[model samples]
Target: MASNVHSLSARRTAGKSAAMMPPSPPPENLELDGLDRLLGAIYEGPMESPPWQNASQLLRERLGAAHVTLMLRPPSQDGSGAMINTGPTQQQHVDSYESHFFAADPFVRLPEGEVFSAEELIGPQWLQSQYYREFLQPVGVRHLLGADIYTREGIECRLRVTRGPEALPFDAGDKSLLRRVLPHFKRAIQLHARLDFLECERALFAGTVNRMLLGMISFDQNGQLLETNQEARRILAERDGIWLSGNNLCIDSSQESRDFQRMLRQALSGGTHPRAGSEPELVEAIAVSRPSGRAKLGILVRAIPLGPWSESKQRPAVAVFLRDPEANAAQPSQELVRRLFGLTRMEAQLALLLTEGLTLDEAAEKMNVRRNTARTHLRSIFCKTGVTRQTMLVRLLLNSVLSLG
Candidate 1:
């Protein structure tokens, strides 16, 4: 078996070299125009949308591949792995591959930074494996180029391009292109995860809070209603000072209600301190005579920060969950380099240090970087980011960028 594998490797190398003969250059203007349109569509929104499909199709077209497949790791137990196929036989090939060959597939297990070649995997020795012979050969798959998609969560997905007998060997240019697009893919996947998580949490929270006897409402640090229990909505409806206006839970308060309003505002503005004592006291003091002879109303407010969700160090927004008192309070760029900007764990830590108002020298000391080298990295960051100053960069990240979510 070992000797057979070696022979297969030799054959694959020869085949790959033979296949490397250059093809005629594609129309640069036309290809660039198509790419621009495709990128625009991809950036516009959801993956399942028409624009996204168009972009994927265009990529396959431009790459001149026989098939393109985007597979997402299943999000839930019952969620079958996501497979978007652009060729007639691709879906069957993928289904068979997943069912039969995935476990023994060498390429799938490759490290995050490396790319895998189909020629290597499709070598004669690999074909000798019963699983590959019976499953893969039947499917007519001859080559594959797979790039890892690393997320803050971890390396959970991969993007694969496949070809058949007519397909050429994957080149360095293909690898570079894949690397360039990988970040965008990562961001889109992350955004999708965030929206899905938020929706699930909102549904669960709404159900749980609505069942509670106490009214509950949640807001972002900016006082925007992040969520509200049904009870909270009902209670707000009864009160003249607070009402639901479109999406916002509007609060009306007078001088007497100022303190409660202020506390709510502070909490909404990302203030971390608990207001339990202050809130109940203010609620009791503000209770007014109602026609029914019950005390008017009061509020209990608390600020909760959703901490980092993954190893990425991106912090989620602060959520202020509240129970109404008679009071109220208030408060409130980037392109590819900006949007695609990512750092390794170490780089992110360095960014955090810098954001904490550290001078390059100080940051280097803290991070144990030599001052000159620290200056070098800082320069790289600035040039890659187009930010002129550390202060501006830090400011950009202060509220928006987090090392993790």
Candidate 2:
């Protein structure tokens, strides 16, 4: 959501004589132009930020009010509400209102969504009360006009125009303009809330994907990187078999890169082209050679679903998944392997090492186990896991759910 842009400070006057006179009638076209600008600003971002500030300033200038405030009322006694005021507001007045006076203000009691003047709510006798004399008087508030706007989030948003004691009272003309602009203000705020919701959902999905062992990257039709989550960032930073070239994902081998490019293009094109007698199968994975010649970086390119109702109209059209067997193996999932396949902790550790491209002799040396002991674990692993070859065992370990965490 767009955040609030600016705040106001109330100005303290030595004497009422120092205050500026009310602005003369503004040109009608100028007011209309301001409304048009306000509407455009609404589509830019959430109204909590620049739009609210801009609206207040424009309304203040047009209505010739001493100040303008548009904010949400506190929904709960303990909750702070949204506030955007047009000023150079006085800190003293601001503090006083925030501390206590706001709750006592008679304006909140007015009927919702109706424009009313200060006199309509409080008469001369009511104005004699301490809330007015002590709080309103010191703040230089005299006459005012405002209306309430309903938000989609069920918050009561209020807009108020205030005048100084020396200024003319808010008249029908001022209220008329506010009434005209109120609908646009409400719609803009609702639009902001909707956009904010969609943004939150996207973040939640990305977070879940990031927690997986795979590194995920989203790219557009031109292969421009669009988004990469936390795990993807860590993998890309390694600059191993697969790395980013400028903003594009690149593979170490040229042939592999060509294959990847064709696969991505085919997927995005909906696999329309026929190969021999039938449409080619979608390529699911590609292997990139590592500099260490150990475990290669395994990349899986998948197409984002495309349709009229699909969410990818503006988002990325393709996503790439990267798996670093060596990196994921380094994490202590040995206990997980032990429990899943009935292997001892030692045997699990040996299996993890083999997934890192360690030969039988190398793994035996690293684990400080004799050749016979290592071979014994290997035979037991094959029988229990139902995979006879080392290569098959390595693939099984990588594919296992235990490797994800």
Candidate 3:
């Protein structure tokens, strides 16, 4: 695994001595509505960009603390980790903790799933420690309440809340409240990690499909378009053979339209049907004729698979993949092409045009160059690409990952 350390330094105010203060009285009774809202925020934390910002704020308010910091990933010497702090502390204070003070602080590695205070964990000796004088005291962090959660997903997260000397120290009531919500908090972190992984995979596959010059369109059970990629939108906007009529997929030819609708219905049925003891759904294909006399658009219709326990929702039931044989294949930038094959600008441009299905004479005319110049560039492209024929050169360029750039 790679390190997550980043330059997270920021500016903050000067520190003050943390006077030994008596523990404050226990807090008021926890309200049912407040608990409900806090639980909701905890689950929603994973979806937040900074993860758990709302939950951290709510927890801070509930505890009446100066700051609430959730160390989703602990800070390291290299200054890499995921930490969220909810407080009015200066950026420098945060920078100090993330960059350097984190290592010296003795509040970490708490008893798993148990909440503890600075006094309970470190005793009276904590006040004389270097961490208190140089780091916590300077920022007015006098009292600390912390809990550690180790999930099955291999995440060791710490929740810490601090109070200034002016405020009362944490009490039994505060620890009780934290203990009550700790289980929910652990589950939320697990849910977030799982979702984060799934989202990354989804983006990777989506980008690969788009780079392949394939148009993907997904439809709901009602035949309404649910989602589409950039290539699909581009193909529909051209309106050569297939396009959208309102929100419905359409073909220029009546016969093809009927065929497409039938296939779409079959695909939808396959997706929603019971999966147990069912035969695999057959993928359907069709060629949509163009009015402009261009090559027919190749379309493949298939069902989006569903798990046995899938719920009823407005989701993609059928998917359509469109391939335009006459359309230009996605090409890398001229500079990229030049670097990949060690070809000059002119040679790279000529190679790109050839990949678009243009003949040497047509490409030369487009580039405002003579046919003989185009031929010379072509010969050079073949030699640089280690191919002997024009078709081989085109095939090589199309098969390469250059288009993914």
Candidate 4:
């Protein structure tokens, strides 16, 4: 597994003195909100971009440190690990630390989860060693205080809060604040584990019916919702005229609502359509209007045909396909365009706009670039994408499955 350490640094801070003064009091109110934020991080959105980073940042401020980093020590592959740090460290510094310097650093070679002062982890002698001069001195980090936080999946992650040379060493008060917030991190890890499982399941189910640019809703024999794709979820969440009230699917108009329920019931019961003898399975398409007076949602409802002996318990009796005319299309993978076609980021953006039916002038105006620059980007895009005419460029992009965004 490739380690993707997103902008995390391994920065250490100031020297320790035996008679160090106590740090300022921990912010109780902010820490309470920070704990809440950490719990909500797992459920906020994609697990790929959880709010744990933000929570860690909050901890940094609360603990009165220059920067905070959460690092996976002895990386999951049982090697030197990755870091997720908050600070103004360069990517070069991060790469240098993980690839070379981290292995020699004595701070990471300590006991886990127990708060340790830098003095405890590495004595003054080691701090002045060659590793310190070559690495830490240049980075301007003098010392760090750390504690290992446990995840439900048993991933080994340690939190390191750094201070600069001028700043005093982290005191007991800082350690106490970290201890208070530790339980929140422990619970957040469990939530992360559960979300991982759920997201995997959602991907599997959505892949079945929503591979195309369509939203799907699976309903049971009693018109109860069994499941829905992410797109269907967005439509339901909007409550724009059509929404789900309890388990029942509902539309705006009372007359249309009655018709929708009747059609849904018929489809769910596996009964013949009104024109069953001729059409057998006529797809029932409806225009669901929005209460906001926006464009109507186009929904197509149809019955799932199965043999009398079929024993699929999880199968849906009725499926609804929803499409909002105004909904944004799935963005294509800009990475793919850059890698495959060698278009620069700006050129790729212009290419995407061109595909979206935007004229050169319009694309320029939207990009906030002059028309000449836009034309220059367009020319580069044409060369890279292997197309000349705007029509051909649109055709290539429309047919290709590069839009992973």
Candidate 5:
């Protein structure tokens, strides 16, 4: 960890030193129209598959190079990093560079936002280096141009261009063009990072809701459906007690439907109704009976939060949460249960069945075991878990974090 920290610090220091240097003036012939097109491609990078494919391809063509590559993440000792290449280089060579040569290559950590050649950075000794001799030589690659980009988001990445041994070395024109576009590339990378973070957070919260077995449904001010999670979609599709009727929620019973609609209207009205001050009116709950006679579906309606000066149209201003009594809550696997309580396979199975509200006899019947054997497993489970009775054992397992797994 200390070595990793030092490496990052050194890289940042190099970037800072490079950034302190003033950039050269843009060339007179540099076409703004082409740059504008490239900028559009760059901004569209975050949404593209393989990210920045079109932009990078355009960049490669613009630079007139054989290959263009982006090291979105630099290689580390742990073998983590991404390298997207727009060349015909064989996959094996790419894999080899990522696995082995990345450490020895001296072309990295280029002056931040400043493009430079391998010859410029390494002087005359560039051709004699182990990385060049063993890897670059074998692949017939010679000329190299690279720039480092650093973003406010702490993202440090490198862009590299390579040409064949016979091709001319990258000149001032190539470097200048790359220098002009490096900032935009940095911004695109930052945007991609933020988008990735948000998607991860969304998935985490959605997964938690699913694990809790709650059916979440959101509605706009007009009581039109806005969003529904997987659980809510399942319940609605079944159409047991409550479902959709042309995007509007409908209850099976006429009286219950009227009550539900009244609550929705009151909630969507921003709580300005006559019953606003009453405790029961703040959050209304109803039990809708199902035609299948399984169990009543629990529904809770509440108003969405509003700002003092908020005035948005067709936005979510009501929330309806549904709970089906017959739906099974997520349970910990038998292996997880065994590991958590030091119980054997049979004991874990019995414990899980009990946690599901099953009697010892019913569990024994399901497991194809005698009732006495089930009782023995139960006693062992109780002793190991420090629970005196079956109910306490159930409570312990039910309250554990294993269910969230």
Candidate 6:
């Protein structure tokens, strides 16, 4: 009876040991349909929304893991200087770790395509290192699974999954799962970076347009206004050229209006004027004429090539300029200041004399005004604006009015 009882106990012990052993081959073929479904969800909307926060939650549910994190190494700094936590925790931990352990981290230094097991991460030798004890263990992380996201711009983003102490070490199944979903993560990272770049480019373009002096008006090939810079809007509004009819630009003066329309028609036709050879001649023609008191206003027409690959080879454009003797006649006012500031008759006359190196007395004499009266007008002009002296005033005026034209 004693022998039989001992035999039964030994058999039961053997059965428990066998059950406790890790499953052979680690179930590497576990179902990946759920992972595919998760990836599909991420791609459903604009990549920015349902951002990393949403992604972390979905990954936690699908992978049955305790936490997940995404870290970014900015080009300006070494190691993972910019870390994003997409896990349950609101604050970031990896950034703090990277700052302290950048030089000691084997995973960061390892080349692409290399893989490491969780045992290697938490082993006594590795764990003894300050980084492991101070950063990883305190956070309840016993195992780590990591992969790299590479970009064409030479940036590397690291994605990591962490498991708790009670959980079994990441098995072959987990590694296989990571391998299958890595491509999706890579796509997400690239998409996110691209969206960020596009936003920055949009802001830069807007800033540049706002800073320009020459009013810029963009039109479709059909002569419909697509967009206008602030300066262009102001000019159009002042000249009564902005029209609500079918979103078209309309000039008030009949002759100038006709010229603008003709120039636009030519531009849209995509026809190039005959040239002598392969080198096309750059030419400007008069498109419109308007009478402003004793002076004539004209729109100068030209053709500019849209791009290196444009089929039209040339795009038609028109620039409006004053043909008034007062505007064209070389005198005291620099051409730019007269056009930009809407200076009064006296102000323009004063500016021209100053630009030609004339003294206050000399300018006053030329203008047939008393010295005291000229000085008074100059003082009023300086005070209305913030210019304190002549040189500074000249610079300010030039900066406000000048353009690449």
RMSD value for candidate 1: 25.2
What's the lDDT for candidate 5?
A: 0.86
Error of 6 at 116 (Å): 4.0
Tens digits of per-residue lDDT for model 4, 7-124: 2321112223323757756798666776676546523422546336766666776666778887744443255565667777788987777778766766664454478877776777
Runs in model 6 lying further than 4 Å from the true structure:
1-60, 74-80, 92-106, 114-118, 121-129, 137-140, 150-152, 165-169, 183-209, 215-405
Q: Rank the candidates by TM-score, best first.
A: 5, 3, 2, 6, 4, 1
lDDT per residue as tens, model 5, 1-405? 999999999999999999998886577436776788899999999999899889989998888888889989988898667988897789898889888999988987777877899888998899999999999888888998899988777888989999998988888999998999898999899999999999899899888887878898888766778889999989999999889887888899998999998888888774442232333335789999999998899999877665445566576677789998889876678899888999999999999988888889999999999999899988899889998999898889878877677
Off by over 4 Å in 2: 1-31, 43-51, 73-75, 90-99, 129-136, 151-153, 270-283, 306-314, 326-405
- Quick one: RMSD of model 3? 15.8
Candidate 1, which ten residues in sequence have the lowest lDDT sum? 328-337
TM-score of each: 0.43, 0.64, 0.72, 0.47, 0.74, 0.48
In model 5, which runs have C-alpha deviations exceeding 4 angstroms?
1-30, 87-93, 99-104, 128-130, 133-140, 150-155, 165-167, 219-227, 243-251, 254-284, 302-319, 329-331, 365-380
Q: Top model by TM-score, which number?
A: 5
Write the residue-wise lDDT of candidate 3 on 1-405 in tens digits: 123223222111111122345545555333777888899999999889899999999999989989999888898876577889899878777778788888898988888878999889999999999999999888888999999999877999999999999999899999999999999999999998899899999999999888787999988766788898988999999988889888888788999999998888887774444353466655899999999998899999977776677676577777899998876665679999999889999999999998888999999999999999899989888888899999999899987878787
Candidate 6 structure quality by residue, lDDT tens digits, 1-405 = 999999999999999999999885534345445665667755542254545656666776766778877666632244346655655553445555655655555555334543455456446566576656777788887777877767687768777788878987777777776666667766777777788799899767655544543345555545555665655565455453333355676765676667666766675554653223444533444532333443333334444445444443223232222222223222323445556555666776776676656888999999999999888877866875578898876666545534322
RMSD of each: 25.2, 14.0, 15.8, 19.4, 16.0, 14.8
Give each model's whole-structure lDDT: 0.60, 0.74, 0.86, 0.73, 0.86, 0.60
Error of 3 at 341 (Å): 10
With a 3 Å backbone cut-off (N, CA, C), the pairs that clash in candidate 3 are 5-80, 10-92, 11-92, 12-92, 15-138
Q: Cα lDDT of model 4 overall? A: 0.73
lDDT of 2 by residue, 1-405 (tens): 123222212223423435666566779877677778766654553644554676677678878888888765543357555567786687666666766767777777456657888678776665777777888777788777878887657857778888888898877888877887787778877877777789899887776565565688887655678888777889888877677877877777899989888777776664542233354334478888888678878888777654445444445777888887766433547778898999988889899889888999999999999989999999999999999899999999877775445
